[model samples]
Target: MTKKNVDDYLQEGMYGTRLPKEAERKHFLGTLRERVILALTIGEVMSDRGLEKLETEMKKHPNSTLLMNGSVAYKFLKQERDLADKYKISHTTISNQEHQTEIGAVLTYDHAIDKEDIYLSNDEDQEKSDSVEKDDQKDQGIVERIKSWFS
Candidate 1:
């Protein structure tokens, strides 16, 4: 049976529309969580008590990155959400703007299959390099012959 994971989630507004596999969803969630955690943890001057409490609270929500009801946490979440949206990491969701009280920014990543548009072919590159090397070797041989004649 398909596990009830992020795919089961109803992403409203601006979020990933493509239904990601469970593994992909988990990976995306993990990345987003890490970003959120970093945001919540770094570059803040707080009392030892507050810092300890924050750490404890973070442990409580391993899957999440926000400290509950923290404006700073929300700020970081918003930043991360914006970046996610910009990069098409997830589908657009109204909750992207709204502060997440529980999970802290439910990221429904945009799981669009990306198509690589490479201009240069590897074979063509290899052929060009080979031709250049052959020309260089011929030139070197010609130079050596001229040097021998002079000698």
Candidate 2:
């Protein structure tokens, strides 16, 4: 049999498998929103206070994900294996264009969503909510408002 082409798979509904459904897309976006604010706050805290401060903060909570530079994480792990092992802290190295040395606790997506106010600053949350409200207002046209009024 001949090899199936892109069009053949598209016709068979095999393509776009990675695309999320409407509800899934909304959930994913909300999760990302929480993670972004958490990460940003953590980064700022870490930068201002250093890794030791971050460690002290993380010690308050169990199973919080910690992000650090690869080299720093390696050295820290080698030097403090006992502490790391005791806390069961997961060490993750993020490599990106931004030059930063970050080490702080992170909440899971679900936890962040449930505790968004705790994770995100008031200003950040207000900004995001305001933008969302604007988009919603834009979505509701005059016709839709009139229909709602009658109903």
Candidate 3:
């Protein structure tokens, strides 16, 4: 038996999958529109706030698929555009590069949170030292009283 080639498969109507029907496409677009609207509303509210605010607003939506959809993603792009307009800044100032940087920063923060060790490095040992100092200060009065009683 001979194996069918790409051209043979195309000729047999088995290469590429069929496109969605018109009604299905329309329904998909309608869902996209709704997701975009929701994302836009969240983005607008979060424009002046940080990622924590954005995440909080996005959580309210509760539709994970909407978060991954391109139409909904465009809402964030549009948000930066709107912010640029409000500030009278050029659209180029809020380019895809900026968006990518923001995404990177957010992902880094998420990764840090997911890590078992909370401290990034031994540099955080300063917090431990500070706590020890506070305890020493609290015990200083007791130490003085003991010394006075013995004297």
Candidate 4:
């Protein structure tokens, strides 16, 4: 008989349990770094207890810089939900503002500053140096000839 795969094993002769939703999966895979940063930023609004809980939740993830945006969004949403429930405020307000701020931070951090600006500046300096060297060479030839005659 053919070997069964993981899906077959999971199904056990019936359809496997429904897979996690896309958003759920994304949220589940969010990075610790993003979560910590989010917590710190939000701590400005949340209580020490809330911040502690958030930090505890973040500790469950591996410490690394490679956090995914979807996961970060998921963590933010979760925190916002918790804070809203705790403080009796509209979750939408915090979520919307945090979403905007997070989006801006992610865009800024992910983009690398181009080195072409420094490179172009250095090239200009090099051209100037080359021109000075040529001028010095021309001056040296005539000056050297005069010195030789005087000697």
Candidate 5:
């Protein structure tokens, strides 16, 4: 390896170590895409869709860490955090003030696993969205019943 130059030292000191795929890392909550097992968007996190799949992934990748976007409210991310605690998986909520990430949560290992796709499939997303819709409908029904009683 070549000797460190003054410029390199200054750069490293000011910005920390230079890493490839910085943009991707920022998007994936300080992890690489290849290292991610599963990733969820803010919408999915709020709706809590495919959480069972997330749990399954967690069980499968025991060493994986759960990285949640700090931008999201803790209330929305609480369930996933609880799951991580239940399974004894290490997890952290990361935030990059300079960039806004749409992803709400990620299941990832320290090293690259190099999986082709990390996001949930359309079928799973659709199924979960459908379930959320049904739940909303049920809550609406109960509200209607209460309203009728009051009237």
Candidate 6:
């Protein structure tokens, strides 16, 4: 390989190597969206709402890195770090002084996997809603039965 010249070194020092999809990387917490396997919101991380989903993704991508937003309180992110440890995945906390993202955590691969969806599935949320509907139906059934007896 040819040695880099003084001018080349100076230019590189003046401006860091260009990264592709920089805006997407900034929004996704230092990783490209396509490389991400899963991303969690700050509220979800704090409440442990997406913990299971995160863990499951970690299990699936054991070689992936877990990148947590350092702006969030460590207590909220510690659980995720522990989960990463369980899966033997390396984890890092990203804190950019110039940019901050609402994303609480990201499970990412080094290379572009171009995953279509990186957010947790809402199946649990869907199940909860279904349960609520069932409860409402049960209440309606009891009321109808009482009305029939009174008639």
- Cα lDDT tens digits for candidate 2, 45-105: 4344233433454576556554433433344434233444567866454443333323333
Taking all chains together, each candidate's TM-score versus the true structure is 0.28, 0.33, 0.22, 0.24, 0.73, 0.73
Best by lDDT: 5
In candidate 4, the residue pairs with backbone N, CA or C atoms under 3 Å apart (3 or more residues apart, or in different chains) clash, namely none
Global lDDT of each model? Answer: 0.38, 0.45, 0.36, 0.38, 0.91, 0.87
Deviation of model 5 at 129, angstroms: 15
Q: Which pairs clash (backbone N, Cα, C closer than 3 Å) in model 5?
A: none
**Order of models, best lDDT first:** 5, 6, 2, 1, 4, 3
Ranking of all candidate structures by their TM-score, best first: 5, 6, 2, 1, 4, 3
Per-residue CA lDDT of model 5 for 1-151, tens digit only, reads 9999999999999989989999999899999898889999999999998588899998898888999999999999999999999999999989889999999999999898898768876657687899999999999999999999999
Residue-wise C-alpha lDDT for candidate 4, range 1-151, written one tens digit per residue: 9897887787865845546353432232322122223322222223233344333333432231222233234544464345434544322222232232322111011223332221122444687999999999999999999999999
Which wins on lDDT, candidate 2 or candidate 4? 2
Model 1: number of clashes? 16
Question: In model 2, what is the error at residue 89, expressed in angstroms?
Answer: 1.1
Q: Which run of 10 residues does model 6 get worst, by summed lDDT?
A: 116-125
What clash count does candidate 3 reach? Answer: 0
lDDT of 3 by residue, 17-113 (tens): 5453534323333222222322223333234233333344334433322222133345445554443344443322112321222111110111112
Question: Pairs clashing in candidate 2?
Answer: none
lDDT of 6 by residue, 77-108 (tens): 98998899888999999998788788999999
Error of 2 at 6 (Å): 3.2
* Per-residue lDDT over 54-144 for candidate 1, one digit per residue giving the tens place of the 0 to 100 score: 3443344344323222333455445544444444343222222332222322322122323232112333467799999999999999999
Off by over 4 Å in 4: 1-117
Query: On a 0 to 1 TM-score scale, where does candidate 5 land against the true structure?
Result: 0.73
Off by over 4 Å in 1: 1-7, 12-120
Model 6 quality (TM-score): 0.73
Clashes of 6: 0
Q: Per-candidate RMSD vs. true structure?
A: 17.4, 15.1, 15.2, 17.6, 9.4, 5.3
Looking at candidate 5, the ten consecutive residues that score lowest on lDDT are 116-125
